[model samples]
Target: MKYFYYLLFALLLCGCQETKKEKISRLVNEWENKEILFPKNSFFTIFAKDTIAFDTVDCDYKVFTYIDSTGCTSCKLQLLKWKGVIAKFDSLTHNNTAFLFYFHPKSAKEIAYILKRDNFNYPVCIDDADSINKLNQFSDEMMFQTFLLDKENKVLAIGNPVHNPKIEKLYLKLAMGESYTDKPILSQTKISVDKEMINLGTFDWQKKQQVAFTIRNEGDQLLVINGVTTSCGCVSTEYNHEPVQKGKNLKIQVSYKADHAEHFDKTITIYCNVPSSPVKLRIKGDARK
Candidate 1:
């Protein structure tokens, strides 16, 4: 009917009106300074192999992360990445910050295997009953699930710094007792990419495929690329770390290695000193024999 179509149009328009910046602002406002509750009766383990007692240490800050069993366990946990982050923090703060990880897994065996495979030696709470998530009712978005907490477990910021460079800077600044600013102070510029979406068509699932994207600086100022982050471990990106001068082009090489035979859609985010700093590109296709 005409009325039904009009209703759908309004809904789509409203959805399009909400920008990523606005959404992040709203989420941060809702969670900032909120206290997080941790259930007492939870199982703890080290490297997912040895039984351990959960001990609370008095630290200046705590980075708490909760992973629920829904998607690929290895991908969601990203234990290897966590290992690096933990090392970095320890070097800087010297036990001033604690990393608390809780995972509610569908299969305890899979979780254990992933932990060991990644060689993650940190203590983790394997909540098979999902008690932590139930008690906290954490947000469904992955970005909002991780929290940078104060000594009392009050949220200082909500985001995974490992996945986002901007959030990492913010977390480090706040944790170190330094003044913080959410906005970047550098001059803003613009970028132009050859393509935002790359369709690989169909390829052998077991083999790796590579694609390159050309990004050119369209602004007068130098464009500094902070980092490039992927949605999954199966995908990786390579780019020059040096700043790209105006009117120059930079090549980004993205590689995808499928672990299973299925349709896949992965995201690659580029962080730069530009107005739209975090530009996202997609690679999607079917993997077959």
Candidate 2:
């Protein structure tokens, strides 16, 4: 009787272990098939490749060269080109290793300097003639895919126009000889705002005009406005000192001083954390003596 009880307990523990393993396997499969969307107006794609069964696709590539403030150059180029590349694809055909390159530059001038300093000697300008010919054998629209390739020119991953960070994590997991499962989809925050275009009409010297607008934060996240700037110095704006809470409205006050007699058209750009789009205010009027 004692032997039978021990055997029963062991069987139960093995059954529980098998159940956990099956759940993990299912999650991994789901992650492998997950689809990610690109950020607004961004062009990139992200995906994972098994590395053993994929091949490289033909595409025009551009290399981004980085030069430091001290004139030291860091050359890292994309293996795939961007020609005839669309933002969508079913899968990659190559089994190549992909690497993520990170760089930090203070300004756009540094980015430009690096490109010019190198005289474009990097491989970002190359295309595989054989791959190009084979890719061209397919329809033009079919040439839009970009794949991450291994050192041997095998496709390890594929993406469209947007890069997927989850896919990158998967690659990292594979490199570390670890397994990863799909993450649960998180709820997205929503943002909504009221936009208006104001016509200040005309103003005389020493006169001021008031333009009123409301800002509401409808997203789950807090909205932060870093600053407000005007195209011309004559215009000034003010917002409520308190942040507009979710489902609450805040007022924006813009005042324009007609210090000079001239025909003026100006714009106020509101720099905010709202991801839907940036808020733009238009102010137009003529100053009379």
Candidate 3:
């Protein structure tokens, strides 16, 4: 009777497990039909032309770049190049493509100063809440982020066009009412970690400690981890979500605050495009106040 009960319990546990694909499917379906909100800006002015309203600007393509501080030299270059290339075509003249830049919410002061210093001749708007972030339907980490949207505000591609040929090609093709020739983007990841559990041993309750987990792209394709969720509020995380090429590694730093004197066990659930996503990481230690 004991043996039979054990077998039944094992079977029940196995049935409760979710496959890798099911998680990814769930993530995608959540935002598939969600409309991109072009939230109104706090202030907007054209560098050289008449001011325009957000809803009044009509175009088939909208390129959004988030800007704050001007520390990224490459970002400046990309912005310049984008302005030059986009200038050859104007939405006012029925070019069907519109490229606009925005301040990353509360960055208007810094961004405005930089634009003036650089003699930026492009349309820049102030969105104090980074409203454009909503367009990121499939990823997290919005720094240096850009999105290519269609007339109906559908996210067609998610990337920085600075010097990327693929993005430029995608833009030009779509502008001409054509489709891209490349394979569709997966927007998913196949990743594995070096360790599933981290043992912090013993620590003082008032002290804070951090442990690092090395995440690797073990598949033959790209690996993307968009978001991370913790089981407890006492734990926080920092990580890079850049596309992890095959064989490459990304590290996630988990910081735990020992506020209570007890044996602690915590889990960090990460969101990614993987076969077995929502990867759960474990951390444990004894804390003494």
Q: For each candidate, give its TM-score against the true structure.
A: 0.86, 0.34, 0.43
Ranking by lDDT: 1, 3, 2
lDDT for each of the candidates? 0.77, 0.40, 0.59
Model 2, backbone clash pairs (residues 3+ apart or across chains), number: 27
Candidate 3 accuracy as lDDT: 0.59
Colliding pairs, model 3:
20-275, 20-276, 105-128, 189-273
Quality of model 2 by C-alpha lDDT: 0.40
Task: For candidate 1, give the lDDT of residue 111.
Answer: 79
Q: What tens-digit string does per-residue lDDT give for candidate 3 at 159-232?
A: 44443434455556656666445433476556778999999998898899899999988788788765565655
Which lDDT tens digits does candidate 2 get at residues 119-138? 43222211112233232221
Note each model's CA RMSD in angstroms: 7.5, 19.5, 14.6
Quick one: best lDDT, which candidate? 1
